[model samples]
Target chain A: MDAPTEHLPNVAEALARAVDTRASRERDLLGELEALGAERERLRVAILSLEAQRAALDPIEAEVRAELTSLDDGAHEVLFNSLIAQRAAVAARAELVAEAARAQRDAARETTDNIDALLVEYRQFRDVIEPTLPDLPATYRSVLKAHHDGVVSRLRQFFSRVGADPVPLDAPALDLDVVIGVDGDGAEAVGVTIAIPVSGDVRAATLEGAPELELTLAARVVQAIYEGLDAIGQPTAVTAFGDHRGLLVVEVEVEPTDRADLVDQLLGIMEDVLGTSAELLAAGVRVRALEVPADHLFPPEESSDTLEDAS
Target chain B: MSEVAPEELIVVPLAVAAERLQIDPFEFMRLLVMMGEVPATLQISEALIDRVRAAAGIELWWAEDVLLPTDASPSRAIVRAALRQLLERGFVGARATRIDNLWRGRPEDEALLRRAVSLLHREGMVGMSRSRAGVVVSVSPAAVPQLDAAVRGESMPAALAALA
Candidate 1:
């Protein structure tokens, strides 16, 4: 079990390297501890000095009372009265200093507590972000875009199935507008807007004493659209507008980007709406088309016929 | 001593009932005449009947044939005609011979009449009473005195005037 002489230098080198690394870390830790200890000691000394000064006020007030009792002549009494006033001022100032010191100590303790809590939170945040940090920017953007696209595609599918024919074949039948932005944490944020064009027969009934059938039909169509959107399980903010003619404009906004299968889910919703539409038509609600406007796919600023402004 | 229960009755005004049936008061009186087993009648003064015969230059035996002042009032005339017909038909009784200002019809027609009377009551044109027997329809007590005064050929009473 004699020492392997050939491996001695390598062992020694390894030992020296471990010692050097340990020593460097120890020095850094010791430096930080020393700085913290110095700060604590300085605060302790300050508080102690204030306490001593406050304690001295009692003895000083006793001496003032002794001096007041010794005063016999009127002039001496006046001077002793002035001395008492000065003593009272000093006592008041000492009380103020003690209060300030106590406040500082409490603040320091609160700061220390906050720092401990913040350190835990910071570690958790780092753990969460560390693995994704390298590819976060690109991945975030792509995910945001995919979510926006999914919503738009689902909405388009929904409109295609529900909307009447003469559906614009080459262009987007409905407007699917998305706004993408970077958040404070560099995560991509997205907003989606879909505009659906609603058209129906606005012709006034020629029969005398007939009710306002067009307006009634428009209201029914808008209600059906709202119900259909709700049934589809998509969180959309819907707004409806009537042009006073036969056209109703419905704008739906999908703000949340969490659902990945938004389009497919909406197509499933259309199946339910088709049954509802058949019943509605039988009830004399004659809405011909509830399609998305072809031009709405482009940015709202570029489109001349923005349903948002029309509403 | 036994405690007597308060009488509850459903009464509709004749005018109100006529309006509900979409008919004139005279036409309503005729329908009542047709429906009743015993027709309503009013007593005529023999002196008045005789005076009408003399004015018409009719023989004393033909006094009954002469048109009486009852002819001027369709309400009074219909009651007389119905009573005469009932007498000729051999229905003899004081109740059968007398006509009431209020008209009541067959029991089978009660439901239809009650609905019509209820409509008039809802309109505040008549008062009603309901009993175990059935509904009793009549003009409001406030208007009864006025109707009596009209039947007597006198000015409406002060109490009824105040109501008006």
Candidate 2:
């Protein structure tokens, strides 16, 4: 009794019991776990049902939120359409205003252009242009155009006899474009112009298309005009020569005390020329006088055809 | 002595040489001219002048100094002076300008010189080569003997016959 020989005192049975107890506890725990799982499953199913409900209501709530955030029927969009139509109308009016502005600008430009033209013309007037003109009065000297022909020598003699001291051309042999005025001091004259058709052709130096003898007669006609200037003695004549289109032109200046007597003097001179240059007229040399003033200023009319017929 | 003939030789006027030597050309030429006719051609060269200068046994019969006549007209005096210049400078030839300027201190003197030169030219004493600028006056080679004789105080029929 004191010490039992077998030490295995019901340990298997106790282990079996403990095992049964643990199995029972395990079964209970399993059952409780199953219960908890069922409860969790029910909770998950309820949560899914609530989630389904929330999913079902989300679109309606979203519709309400959107309704609060924005307008219904979009009246402001109608306002945008109206603004677009108003923009079109403003553009058309601006186009019309722009057209008017362009027209006004064009008109202003034309007016300015005319004003500028008038200013230029005014600047070109004699009052403005006269100061710049040379103070050199006409001289009783000959202004030879280029090279005068040999007839110039004879003409020079004739001019000298008629009180026209013709200045000699320095290089009469040159064929230049220069019109040389040679003066032996005190040759300048403040007198009236007596333009001479010094040359029948424009070329004085070459006497183009003019015979020497014919040229002699033409120059003599110029000399014959002075016979009628009986009282205008000792008046120096300044001779200027030029070439018009196919015609020789010369201008001379003479002084007269009375401008009123110029018409009579010119008429007398014309008569004298017509009488004196009868040979020239007979030779069919168109000895018509032009650029002569009648009283104030005479027009260059072609009336001297009678002289040719008379000849 | 030159092998070159007188014509081939460079002809320098005796006046040029006399002007260089500052001696009477006519007077010295007399020393060279012999009794014969003046050679048809004479060479005027530096060698000949040197020889003439160095030569010995040469008789030069030149005019002695004499007084100008109290009654000597200006033209006559000009003629005498031209002759003297001709002799003194051996001036056998000169441009007319030179003869003209020679006595042309005054206008009258120039006229006188021109008249004298013309007189000499007309007398056949001088030959002239006319040009646009002026005439050239040269002593006639044939007249050299007579000019020399006149220089030696011989009576000449020319206007300047009494040159000496």
Candidate 3:
């Protein structure tokens, strides 16, 4: 006889609970996929309707053109002169028809493009979720930890590549502090602060003489970093400090839990961001001695001590 | 019947009058004789003559002459005839005066000097000094070089004759 449900081991109950949760999520995703399919069909019909509307104007336009040409050729000048008012009316109507046709064609093209993008997105979502949905609830904790680790690793790689020292992060336990919820509600966040020493040339100039040039360079650097983070679906807050003792500090704080796989994508995004810096460096704005601050390296309780020790 | 006082009659210095007409004082007196209008000559006050002479920077004291008496003044018809003769023979135009100096001209010559002053004032070449003696005038300092250039050579003689 099968074991009684009440007497089943706690581990077995947990396994069963995970399986049920996965099944429920899979069902929800399938429903969403079905809705998306319907939406795609509706879009396809909308595009066809617009195309047909555009085609319908073509015959009327052609008829107007024929009449205009007949008037131009002077095949029936007496009749044409008699219908001069009608000819003008027809010309105006033709122009309006042509305009409507162009508008319709443009609408149809735009709708088709939007539908294509939706389809691509739906397919990608389907591919990702189909194989993983069953195992997601089971590996949820480990996955979250892996994601965090991956983000930190990518950040370290980014710092190393950019000649910056990574500030050691002493974040709380991943399970307790960083929650990667199913509905994308979580506190999984990472903050990276890098100090880029202002080059001798940039530091030599007074801010009063060429303010915009210096500020714009600093702004561009920050914008490049922000763009990189945004592209990877990592919501980031960026702050850039003016040269303090010849150091230009940029702080980037990212919420990795906002999207899945964002941590894995961070390195590539940061590389792109660093590409702009590389260009800036090539243009004679050298940024060196890139490092994270002691405060960022230690927990709040130990941060002061760490800083003092470093000093 | 009317009686005229000598002081009431307009008397001018001969040196100033000759300078106004741009002719030598003795030459002008000779011209008056040739016109059959020989003027009665009278000496101007020494102080007045010296003041005008010094102001005008005229060192040729011998060039100074007696004023032609108004009682024996030449008629306009005779003066006009003399001017025509002078122009036919050619004469220099009037010289510009200093600011502190007074103008002296015979009745017929007064109109010509007045017109010359008006032209200089209109051309912004002279500044006017209002006085009971009449509107005393002088060439502007800036216009001195221009006046000098205008008077160079025999150019003034022809220009003055044209004015006549």
Candidate 4:
């Protein structure tokens, strides 16, 4: 028996998780930015201190100059030379301080640029994955649009859904067999079942409006449908139709919750997956509600042992 | 944005992870996915993912059996699927197609074209047909190995391995 537990969290939970993750990342970025700013300030303070020392030396140089002029000619020359030497030393020290400040500022700018790059990457990643966000990052949306548009073109060129007109494709054509169904309660949600056929040259085959085909051809059709749907997060069931041609029809069924939007989403995903230039002209594929009725939904009663006995 | 401590933000590069595991970056990523070390919804092509996993040191991908280097170049979809599996296993952080261009094909590579089509058929990942333009491969989750022997290959003990 399955243990009873709470159901999975809904869209709200998903949104909350996204928000929390973004918040944490933003905080980290902010911290790095602050550190960079502080380092720049410290460098500026050191530059100011050097300037103060240079200012204090100016008056001392003037007083020494008067004393030098008052001494004997040889003694006066020595005093003047010493004072000039002291001024030169102070100038060199100031230059070193200024160089240090310039280096620090450059380093701080680099640190800020790195942080900006990281933040940009994070933002792009967020836009691609989060569905609830009002808009996606520009690059992501562009890629999706190009892919989606291509898929739509392909869908229109080949297959027709219920009540929709089929667009023409100049290439050799084949139509896949699919079983459509909905759960009991007349749900608008529908599913499709497809059978795989044993053998055929699909490239050479012409559209015959047949519901079944040889074993190989059937398999190829099912494989195509499966690939198309899986790309869009929609899946179908494939099963053997009968032993006559080793035929199998692929089936895809959606549940009640997504029933309303499933077809549109499926169509969109299929077009994207095909990456074709053909347009999808039809809105829906007219499926008989009775063909694969919900009443036929059964328990697993057909035994392999029973089949073996019959064979 | 609030301030975060320096220790809170850490970057893990693919090359660095590959080196740490003593394998190619791809192979290590596969091991991570199979181990369920990351989110399950992450999507990537299987061929690239398998290559990455193999590069990272995880040998014995299913694609190894069905298609050879001679048959066709594995498709980007296969690589993406492998990446998705890796993400689920927590071997890598995440996969974004825009960020991961390593597995994408270059022009004029016919071998990659054939191998990808064949792999797509065998794995049932995508239902794309070969055309004059090329083919599109389906991306799906990597199959989890059911036995320790299957995973450990010839050189290592299965018991030492971790399963997510």
Best by TM-score: 4
DockQ of each: 0.01, 0.01, 0.00, 0.01
True contacts kept of 1: 0.00
Lowest lDDT sum, 10 consecutive residues, model 3 chain A, at: A173-182
lDDT of 1 by residue, A1-311 (tens): 98776644687889999999999999999999999999999989998998999898989998999888764345323432433343233233323433443454355445344433443444343456445656679878577556544443433333233222111122212121111111122122222232222232221221121222222233333333334334444323333232312233334444344333333333343334333433223322222232222232333234344343211
* Cα lDDT tens digits for candidate 2, B111-162: 5556666766788887665322223455766667776664444544366533
* CAPRI class assigned to model 2: incorrect
Provide the TM-score for each candidate, comma-separated. Answer: 0.19, 0.20, 0.19, 0.21
lDDT of 2 by residue, A267-299 (tens): 455555544433233222333333322221211
Candidate 3 lDDT over residue span A9-53, tens digit each? 699889999999999999999999999999999999999999999
Better of 2 and 3 by lDDT: 2
Q: Which residue runs of candidate 1 sit more than 4 Å off their true CA positions?
A: A1-225, A228-246, A258-260, A283-311, B1-164
* Index of the highest-lDDT prediction: 2
Deviation in Å, model 4, residue B142 alpha carbon? 21
